[model samples]
Target: MLTHLSIKNFAIVRLLDIEFSSHSTAITGETGAGKSISIDALGLCLGERAESNMVRKGADKAEVTATFSVKENQSAQAWLQAQDLEDEDHLCIIRRVVSKEGRSRAWINGIPATLQQLKAFGALIVNIHGQHAHQELLKPESQRAMLDESGHHDAILANVKKQSHEYNKLLKHLQSLLNEEQQRIDRKQLLQYQLQELDEFELGIDEFPHLEAEFKKLSHSQALLEDSQICLFNLYESEQGTALSIVDDALDKLSELVEHDPTLSAVTTLLSEAQINIQEAAEELRHYVERLEIDPLRMQQTENRYGKAMELARKHTVMPEMLAAHHQALKEEHAALEQQDNDLASMNENLDILKSSYFESAAKLHSARVKVANKLSKQVTEQLHKMNMPHATFSIEVVSNGEEKINSHGTDEVRFLLAANKGIEADSIEKVASGGELSRIGLALQVLTNKQSATLMFDEVDVGISGATASVVGQLLRDLGERNQVICVTHLPQVAAKAHQQMLVTKFSDKDITETHMQPLSQEQRIEELARLLAGDKITDSALENAKGLLQIQQENLI
Candidate 1:
């Protein structure tokens, strides 16, 4: 329930603070007394679209703050905690600040929030019905929504939502499978070419290493042959003295000098070891000379193998060393694509299973709604009869044949029907309801949904009624107030007399400035205001007596 409202620099209201009672409250004033401004303030607080024109002249900005006592609002409390906002006890203050620059800000419990969040909270806090009710009756979708809201079918709707989700998943899977099949068709020739190239080479991981060794020998063939010939010449075949003979002569001299000194004996031992090493070097040099011959066929084979390896590496965008990993990955991808026909069949089978499961769940939800729709229409029409629209033919507008596609909402569209007179043809309320009739219809639907909603606000609901009809509206308002807190703004004296609490909105001028103020009317002040509403500019004796009598009657009944 809305407990307090504070407004500043909004149109005719410079500054005003109004407190509310938990029962039915009546707001009444003369014409042009800024009565609609109060409801406008509430609309701003509830995240309505605002413009800079709402700001008063000479004012920089406009602001509206509303406080709701959340002692019984468990869902709202949990939502606040989910957002990591404070929820100490059940008091939440939702404030809105609007600037002349078209900037707006919202706050919940003094924590800043966007307009979207403010709307989410407002949906849980209050339901306002004004001329907007006529606008709502125009849309068949809203009619369906209201019927579902009255029947409390959110759980069934949730199940339909889950089914819709599964259907979408299946559709996406089918699209992906088709896309892959198309790609395979486009790349058929390319895959065949690549497969033949790789297979002809008989590629292996160690093939590159063997080819690299051969290429090194062929590319430097002249250098390898020259170095081998030099070794052979020095050790065995050269006409000039070779290294091995030089060492031989040095060893013989050292052997002869060994008899002269023992130091010469150590030197003669080193020469003998050196002569043995040269003899082994001469044998190895003869073998190297015989084997250093280069073959042109082998060189050609190495070059061809290296070119093939380089081509595959460049085609796959990889380094020579990474060629092995790339080769394995392509082989796997080709292997997978080769079996796509079989894989596509498997995916289709899975999609069929998912679609079947989704349809089965949706069918159950549709069954539940079909069972409840007729009963809902009857209930609303019965309530309308009590609200003085006896001839109104109200029914749930649904396709009885169940031919529409099942969606997140079940396969039904609900709308109300009405006729003003006995001979009038029944038409949808969207096409044919008068101003006063629309207000009463909105009131009936809201009061009907009181069990689901937390609080109800009716601003100027008694717009198109007078005399005895106004009294019946008064009685209906009292009935609603008994069930839940109902705040109604009215100019009718009868409606004001029936409220548990009545508030007066008035504007008065003091020298240069005019201010609007709101306060709870005391019992005597309540009578004066009621008389003023009854007798406009002149307070007649009969009007005052009638107002006093109304006050006495309401007090006796309240007691």
Candidate 2:
């Protein structure tokens, strides 16, 4: 429901602000008045395709903003949440600015929105129809979508659609494997070669560091042996008293004194332990000095093995430490290839199951739609009777063209059919001959599909309609307004009479500027405006009387 519209520099509108009600609003004015201009500005704010021509003649740009009451629009609220937009209760503001240079900018709830986002939200908020058929009527998908909306099957269709896609994706991988069996066989051969190369030269994670440490020790063997031999000679075999032999001589002398003094016994025990430690150190040093032989061939062999391992590491694009993991990978790949055929067969079976599952789900959804279509046709027919469209047959039929098959939406083609008079063959709603007939059909669709509290705008809906038929259109509009807001730009006084509020769109021209303005009618103003609509350009006493009587009748209806 649109709460307000503010437009500036849009055509001859210049600046216009209008507040709306939750009831029927009929806007009437002279032929060149700004009613249509107001609609165009509102359309721009609704994210319609815009052009630089929309900008007023000397103005650099045009801006249009609409504030809507959208408390019931859950989908729109969800969209706003995703875009991080502010939603204050139910009010959503959409604004668009079109420059004279042809660039256009848009906003949603004060947060900037792309033209695409504005367009999407616009579809849910308002349905505007005028002298021309809606552009969405051209596409079969749009047609099907509208029909699904008529069926009220969005939630069920959404679930079925999601499950179907999951089932399809789940099955596609295995089917691909089944179809690539020959390729898998070739892949298996490559894996076998890699496996053999890795297995023949097994490597361990810690082996390289261990071997390198050992090699380093062996390379420095001569220097290490010399250092050890010199230290041993200084401690036990040097002329400075051969420390180990001195300890041994002291122990021998202390033993002799122990027989005479008890303190000498303790000194003799300590000297004996020192002599034993010196003997062990001398024996280790002598062995190291004897075995310190550098074998060049062994050193060369170790260097070659290290180089080979490093080269292999570089070849495999991994460090030498990862060789064990590389070997394991080759083993796994070889095993996988060995069982490739069985895996492929399993994949094929799974794909088949998925295909079957999707088809079953789709078929069930299609059946549900068929039932919904018949119900919709009957309900619409029942509604037509109230609109004085007795004997006016209506239907929604499904027709498949073996096309438009994608995995997302199910595969059923549907279209609306209509017949305006008795004994007439029902045909596409677009094929109706009379503008009045089209008006009534459009009215019926709008009334039947009033699932939301959205604002429905009709520009010149009462065109080519008058007499009792025009009165019926007015009644229909009024009833539509009872549940949802109806804003119609009408020429007929009968239609205008039904409005809970009437607005007069008038032109105000000046020497420098010619502009259009709209104002809600004061009580006396309504009488004059209705008279103008009733009697055309000239005012007469009988026309005023008729306009006043119409107002009185409408007032009574309100009572």
Candidate 3:
């Protein structure tokens, strides 16, 4: 429950501080007396959006602080501990500051926090029903959400959500497989073309060097043969006095002289050995020259083979030696493409399984929603009658137009219908319910669904009713306060008199500056304030008597 609130330099409020400890508190003030401003200031501490226009005329900034005693609010306490922002004494203080320049900052338990964090923590500690909550009651989504909350459909909804998530994942995987299949087709066509070209060339690893060598030898055969002949002649096969013949003639002369002188015998033996070596060299050169022939056919064959390999290498932008590696890579790619059909089939099967699971879960959720919708409509309609809207007929419509696609929210559409007056047929709540009816209906739903111990703050909930209707609204608020702390801002004396604690908001001019003041009313002060509410600027004796009687009746009932 909110224990204290402080506002400074906010709108028409200069400085205000008040403490509260009651099951039911009412804030009463004249129109334009800044009654709503106090709630707005509290909202800022709860992380509502802020603007520079909310700042006081002469102030540079506005600040608000709300303190909650969370001794009974375990959820809020646990959240503070989880966020590492818990105070030592289990007290939660939320503060918000807005500068004239539209800059805003927030803190929870004196620790800095983001606006979203503040809002989340605030939700755990209190539920503030703005004066405009009726506007939200008209939204179909809001109606569905409220129904789900009241129905306790969390378990079924979780199943639906899980199935939907997996279904979407399967859908994404199927799309990826389809995209890959198309890509594989393109890749396979390219790889097949490359492999066909490679097959036509009939290339091999290490073959480039051998082919080049053969081509070189065959292309220069005539030149090689001519050079070999000149070399042999110079060495021993020359026509002009062959070297072998010269050596032989010298040896014959030496042989004749060797008989005359025995020392000459060694010279004859040396000449004989030289002649034999020169003759053998001449014979070997003749054989080598015979083997060297000018064959244009063999040369052309080698040139064409080597030329095709080189041309293919250039076309593929690879070295002739690297062509074999490129061909191996293409083969591996083709093998993957061959396996694509199997992979795509498996993905499609999984996609079908996911769809079935999602539809099954969605069907269960839809059934649960329909069952709860009838009970919700009956209960809310009863609550509306209790709020003095006796003729108000409320119902939750759950319907499906065939088998709708599975969604996180399930397949059924939910709407709230209403008839605000007797003899009126129920219609869509948004189209038929007036603002006053909307407010009561919204309160009815809230009162029925809210079981949290957090305080409930209603800002001017009795906006369109007076007299008996206003009194019933007051009693409704009072009854709600019996279970949880409740604060209501109102202009009705009946509502104000019903509060266990009453606070009055009054605006007055001081030195040409308008200032707003708030203070908890004493017993006599409460009666005077109630009288003022009844008589407006003129508190007559009769109005005072009426205020006295209203307060007495509320007190007697409390007893």
Candidate 4:
């Protein structure tokens, strides 16, 4: 519920601070006294768009703050928690500021917030029904929305929307596959040929590198054999004292001197070990040289195989090392292409299933909407009777278009039908009712459908209504306030008298500055305000008496 509102430097309202009750409150004033200005300022706190003109003539900026107590507003509380903006005291303060340059900012519970966030929270907590809201009944979308809201068809509507999305997705997928059918077949044949050619080669991951190494050795066999023979001769068989014979002579000299000096004995041991190592090395070299014979046939065969591998690599536009990976990719692509027909069949079946699912949900949604429409029509018609239209008939017409494709909100087209007189047949509200009748119908519908505890603000709801009917409208608002808060801006004394709380808006001028002010009314003050509403520009004795009597009746009803 809205607990308090503060508006500063907004339009002609310099500063206004007011507290609200949990019941109905009426705002009353003379024409041009700025009664609707309060509602306009409150709208800013509800995230409504603001213009530079909304700021007072000389003020730098305008600001409005609305405070709501959320102890019983579970949805609001949940939203607050979800946004991480919840306060420990369960109070929500929405503040909006607009500079003279048309710049605006908003905060939720002291944390900076986007305008969208503010609007989202506002929708959950308050509904401001302007004088023009009644005209929206002529719109088909609005009519459909009312039916759904009245029926509490959230779950069914969700299912319908989900099914519609799934159906469209499958349809698009199936179309794409069908469009690509011939192209996929051609691709499959090309890939099959490529894979056949690659498979005939029977390539291995490391075979290219090994084959190249063996080819180099076979091609240079004669040169390699000549070099190894020169190395063997230098190590053991050269006529100018080969390394082995020289080491043997040095060992003999050291052995003879070993008894004379201990250092010579160590030298003799080193020389003998060197001779043994040299002899072993010569024998291994000889064996290696013996294995180095050239074979012309093997060399030619190795060169031919290596050259073929290189030619295939260049044809495929890949390095020899990458040939194996490229072949594997072709194999996978061929396999996938071979399965396209089966996949297409499966998708077609899935699309059929999705289409059926959508229609089923659409039918259930239509049924639920029809049931709710019937109940709402009866309820609203009864309400219209109480609003002084005894012969008025109201109905909801739900027609299923049964189009081949579904829409986001299902296939039902809804319209509101109304008959304003006894002998008149019910017809579309757009063609039958005047502006005044439309407002009353809207009021009746709101009173019947609004079961949530949100505060309802009505601006000029009593327009074109007066006399006994005005009193009935007042009573309806009072009753509505029993379970929710109602703030109404009205010119009718009957409506003002019925308010549990009353505020009077007055305009005054000082020198060159004209300002508007609002003040809560005491009992005597309310009597004066109602008297003013009863008698335009003058309060007579009879008007005062009537105001008092109306107040008394309202008091009794409250008790």
Give the top-scoring candidate (TM-score).
4
Pairs with steric clashes in candidate 2: none
Which window of ten consecutive residues has the lowest lDDT sum in model 4?
A: 445-454
Off by over 4 Å in 1: 30-32, 49-51, 172-184, 199-214, 228-299, 313-351, 400-406, 419-427, 451-453, 507-515, 531-553, 556-559
Please give the CA lDDT of all the candidate structures: 0.77, 0.79, 0.84, 0.87
Off by over 4 Å in 4: 9-13, 30-62, 81-89, 97-107, 111-117, 180-186, 218-222, 236-318, 333-341, 506-516, 531-553, 556-559
Per candidate, the number of residue pairs that clash is 0, 0, 0, 0
Model 1 lDDT tens row, 1-559? 7789999988778998998888789988877778778788888887889888888777899999988877777777777778776567678888888898878888888898877887787788788876566677668888777776776568767876887676667667768878777778767657667767777766677677777787888878888888877877877677789777887788788788877876888877887887788788878767876877788887888888888888888887888767776676667778877776677787688767766665666566556665666776667677667667787766656653253453666555566777766888877887888877776676777777664336678778887777766766876888778767788889889889988899988888777676677789999899999999899879988999989987788778778
RMSD of each: 5.4, 7.4, 9.8, 4.2
Stretches of candidate 3 exceeding 4 Å from the true structure: 172-184, 195-344, 419-425, 509-513
Best first by lDDT, ranked: 4, 3, 2, 1
Residue-by-residue lDDT tens digits, candidate 4, 1-559? 8999999999998999999989999999988989898778878888899899999999999999999998888998999999999989999999999999999999999999998998889888988888788777789999999889888779989988988888788778778878998998888888777777778876787888988998999988887888878877988999988889899888888887887887787788788889999999999999989887788998998899788788778988999878878888888887787676777788788877877787788888999999999999999898888888899999999999886667779989999999989889999999988876787888888777774767889999888888888889998998888889999999999888887899999999888888999899999989888988888788999988988999999888767
Worst 10 residues of 2 by lDDT: 399-408
Which one wins by TM-score: 2 or 4? 4
Give me candidate 4's TM-score against the actual structure.
Answer: 0.83
CA displacement after TM-score superposition, residue 461 of candidate 3 (Å): 2.0
